[model samples]
Target: MTETLVVDASIAVKWVVEEEGTPLALGLRHGRRFAAPELLIVECANILWKKVQRGEVSREEAKMAASLLERSDIELFGMRGLLAKATVLATDIGHPAYDCMYVCLAMSRNCRFVTADERLVRVLHQKAPREIANLCVTLEQLSAGSD
Candidate 1:
């Protein structure tokens, strides 16, 4: 059976938007089960908004990206129960609470949180490697089969 992976917005955004490492993120979808907090759509939309504002993608392209993302097969999980733990993780890791929602979900699922957020991966390895190194894997690392 394919292992379930927790994906954050950084990785999910790459799925619908053309970006560096997008191929890696797209490839990760094949034969793998992806799970994310319910806020994934909201985060993705915000990213698309930013892209539009920066003139990186037209409004129509952003809409298409949103439509594609909405149709994707990722399993969504609620973030309510994750709040306290996510907050603790955010505080402990010096990362934002919103991002911690993904990490906390990964912890509960006992799976790797695959992300394209290099800074999050670096921070996790730097601040709490022993505790979280196994919990998070960068998209590049996963694509290289190093995770």
Candidate 2:
């Protein structure tokens, strides 16, 4: 069976940016299923915008990135059903509620929330409930799994 991962913007951005884990994140595309809240679109767009602002990516590259993401096979979950749980989780973890939405969705779907945000991982590793911690895996962990 294919593993379903709930990826946040950090992981998603790697798909377009030639970062350290870009290949690993790309590896997931073939045999795994990816999911995230609709919030991912906005978060990814903002990241792309920032990259453009920093001159790390040209406007044309950002547009291409956005187009590619729009065509990617990621399953997007709506925020309505996730809001309440996400809010409570955010409060509990002291992380932003936006990020918690991905965690909440992963919990609801009984899947892992894969992220590249080290601070978020560390915070959850130190303070989140064991259940929540168990639902998250870093990009490095996911990469190691293929070997």
Candidate 3:
């Protein structure tokens, strides 16, 4: 099976912005298929909204970013079973339920969990009693080898 990656909104946001980690996140598209819960759409929208509010992007730019995300090839997971698993993962990991949702989906689907949230990485490393079998890589890690 082609490798799958569970991408959180923090990293996805970099796909649109030419930030420090943008290239790393964008490079992920080359080797693996990307997946996320439908919640991703809302989360991404919220990021764009914040950028708009901060005057970093114009309203039109925000709309364009939303459109790009909607049209991306990343798969969206919405099954009830997946959500239940996510809830359990949230409890086990002691992270926000929403954050754990991505981790759960990745584990369930045998995929990597990709994010740009440094705090999440630290917490996962500290709290997950056992090593998570799948990769949980940050955008920096993804782009590291190239540079």
User: What tens digits encode model 1's per-residue C-alpha lDDT throughout 1-147?
Assistant: 899999988888898899999989989988899999998989999999999999999999999999988998889999999999988888888889898899889888888899888899888888764766678888989999986
For all predicted structures, in order, the TM-scores are 0.95, 0.94, 0.88
**Residue-by-residue lDDT tens digits, candidate 2, 1-147:** 998999998888889877678998887777889999999999999999999999999999999999988988899999999999989988988889998999999999999988888788778878899898888878887778721
Against the true structure, what is every candidate's RMSD?
Answer: 1.1, 1.7, 2.5
Q: CA shift at 48, candidate 2, in angstroms?
A: 0.4
Candidates 2 and 3 compared by lDDT, better number = 2
Model with the higher lDDT, candidate 1 or 2: 1
Instruction: Write model 3 residue lDDT over 70-120, tens digit each, in one string.
Output: 888889988466777667666877778888778777777777787888788
Collision count for each candidate, in order:
0, 0, 0
Off by over 4 Å in 3: 131-134, 145-147
Return the top candidate by TM-score: 1
- Please give the lDDT score at residue 26 for candidate 1: 89
- Higher TM-score: candidate 1 or 3? 1
lDDT of 2 at 108: 95
